[model samples]
Target: MNAVKIIAASPQEALEQVQAQVGPDAVILNVRKLPIDGMKKLWAKPQVEVLAAAPEQEPGEQESLRQLAVKVQQLEGELHARGVVPTETVPSPDAKLPPKVMQMIRAAQGDKLEEALLPAVQVLEQIGLLPSHARWLSAQSRNFLGATKPRNLPEEMELLREVLSEYWHQLARRLEKPGNPVRVLVGTPGSGKTTVLAKWATQETFLRQRPSRIWRLDADRPNTAEFLSLHGELLQVPVERVWDPDEQPPEDTLRLVDFPGVPADQP
Candidate 1:
């Protein structure tokens, strides 16, 4: 099978492009960071090169996964050789980071014990997280790691996993309030409102075995994202184009609505 070359800014975008072009059954063959030239290397954000192809004409699921795993090992080896993935021989406290996280290793370790959390806080702030929120998370991590004194980098990383696991385990429970059957997903534009709706739909429809439908309504702008419609078709969930805000939804069946994101600056 002929493979298609895709260059995308992130893995999610690359996956979306592959799904759109080669169908959801498509298998990824290889992935790598694209090269930057000249002075562009100083300021340019990195792009990823993905090699993928349709599977019906090629290998089945098991074969596809094996090929994908081999490709991943090769990619990881290349990164490790280039000093991107740290090995045991490196032996630097600052170079090692949390599993699968490469950028969180930048903060220099200082003499103060609290400075150990500096790297995580900086990473959060870089992604538009508020300083206050970062501090709160850091404090929470400290609480879990309190029994152990003078935590090292590895211990701090383990603390992050523990905190994340605790919070996400709570979030994985049933999604509903006592009196609410209709739930609407709302957020700033590009904040994954539709994606969250799809997840909720999966739980409501497939896992719960409950009757559910999806409503795609405009929030401030037109809800142009095709993801909801595509996902609705896949799950066999009835999808409606729009609904009048003045009308109350039927109480018997669960209704998940997809809303366009409002600007964060707007009221």
Candidate 2:
């Protein structure tokens, strides 16, 4: 309960009016002089403000909190290594940073952290680190190295693996089942394609449980075809200068081709 007493031009008149009205034990919280308003005006007088005291903290409770703070500080020091450890030790300030905070700071700081940590991040992620952990470490490392974190890692390694798996599965599905060898040897001139093919054929025959007969296409000319035939005889494989639809290639045989460049106007 609260009370306010207003002083008038005559204190005795005000006291008499209050005594005749409310009892005298009523506490007075404010006392102010009202400015005179003209008799012609019926407007209210301006009021002065008086505020209450705020609640104070208990001394015992405050002491307990201080003690708790000291204990927490001691525990924190014990849990973490001290003496200005390198930035590398800490979790990524950038990667683990809340996204909204990162965005705001990046807008202010600009490509500041990305330059240093992006390469490391890509390397680590490629080796199968969890996404969040990879990003956090990358971001942190970048900030530690005094650079802005990259916006994205080059994830081509993982993407490439996925694409290769898909491609192999599609190829196998197209074949429908295991069959004889199919080989494509393509390279610039003097790339050792012939030597590589021979080595691979040897591997297939001995290690892969599949013996192969190799064929070299010789559609160029009679002289070239004769030379290839001589070479094929040395390698113990068949050589042909033309296609034969009715003849089956040797079991599990790989056919190799060398193509000449197209003429300017040829379709």
Candidate of highest TM-score: 1
Candidate 2 per-residue lDDT, tens place, 49-122, comes to: 22112123346955765665565445445434444222323225546678888678668766454333344344
User: Over all chains combined, what TM-score does candidate 2 have?
Assistant: 0.30
- The number of residue pairs in model 1 that clash at the backbone is 0
- Provide the TM-score for each candidate, comma-separated: 0.43, 0.30
- Expressed as tens digits, the lDDT of each residue in 138-180 for candidate 1 is 7677776434643433344445656877877778665535765
lDDT, each prediction: 0.64, 0.45
Native RMSD of candidate 1 (Å): 17.7
Off by over 4 Å in 2: 1-151, 175-178, 181-192, 205-211, 218-231, 249-267
Candidate 1 lDDT score at position 69 = 53
True-vs-predicted CA distance for residue 93, candidate 1, Å? 34
Q: Report the C-alpha displacement of residue 207, candidate 2, in angstroms.
A: 4.9
